[model samples]
Target: MVTSFLLLAGLGVLVVATAGVSWFMLNAMAPDVLPAFSTFLAVAVGVVTVEVFLGTGLVTLGAFLYNLSAQYSGGVEIAVTEALTGPPPANARALLLMARARRRLRTHIAPGDPGAGDRSSGARPARAQRETE
Candidate 1:
């Protein structure tokens, strides 16, 4: 229902704009009076019909292809979970800071050396180990 109405509304505007232009271009040569409302209505209906028919045809064709292929191989699977939406906890800022600091520490200490994953021992190469000294 929503889609139908929205399509109608969108295409109704297009029809009006096109009719406005047509009216100007044909006003001098055409009859003194024109069937403006009927012409606009007919064109609007035709536009809606074509748009719906094309959209439906494409979707049906896609589904048909997917079905034919799924007979031979397992189709793709998607997992969806209910989202958790709410305000963050009071410690959100502190948690973020700690996580960022840990990432920085990982990059700074023994980036390519063995035992690099042993940083859980709270070790670091501080400013005292700088080349400037």
Candidate 2:
């Protein structure tokens, strides 16, 4: 989505530059038609600018609308399973533990609770231990 917007912006700039160069060349080669050409060039640039901005605005609005609708519709679901391959690296386990700890802290810790150091004893509370078992 972001890539598409960037591409559109790049193309718009390229087209505007081309049009400006063509206008300049026309004025240089045929000074007699400069007035008429200048008027046409101004109108062309205005139209292109408006069209580009309008298109960009519509795309942005569409993305926001989709996000809002997805929030209500439960956007997407994904299922993941551990590979049957050999055990993961040691660092992988540490990273996974860190991620889980972060999630649990966010949901379980009170606003004024001391740091996670207090929970580092490696012993789950009785209720949590029971649920896991």
Winning candidate number (TM-score): 2
What would you estimate as the lDDT of candidate 2?
0.70
How would you encode candidate 1's per-residue C-alpha lDDT over 27-98 as one tens digit per residue? 757866766756756776677667766766665566667767776688863323378755367678878889
Q: Worst 10-residue stretch by lDDT in candidate 1?
A: 123-132
Candidate 2, residue 117: lDDT? 44
Give the Cα error of residue 12 in candidate 2, in Å. Answer: 2.9
- All candidates: TM-score: 0.32, 0.39
Off by over 4 Å in 2: 1-9, 21-35, 76-133
lDDT of 2 by residue, 1-133 (tens): 4544676677777777787788789889887775675676677678777767777788777777877877799885332345676456997898899999999867764555444346686655444655788
Q: Which regions of candidate 1 deviate over 4 angstroms?
A: 1-12, 32-40, 52-133
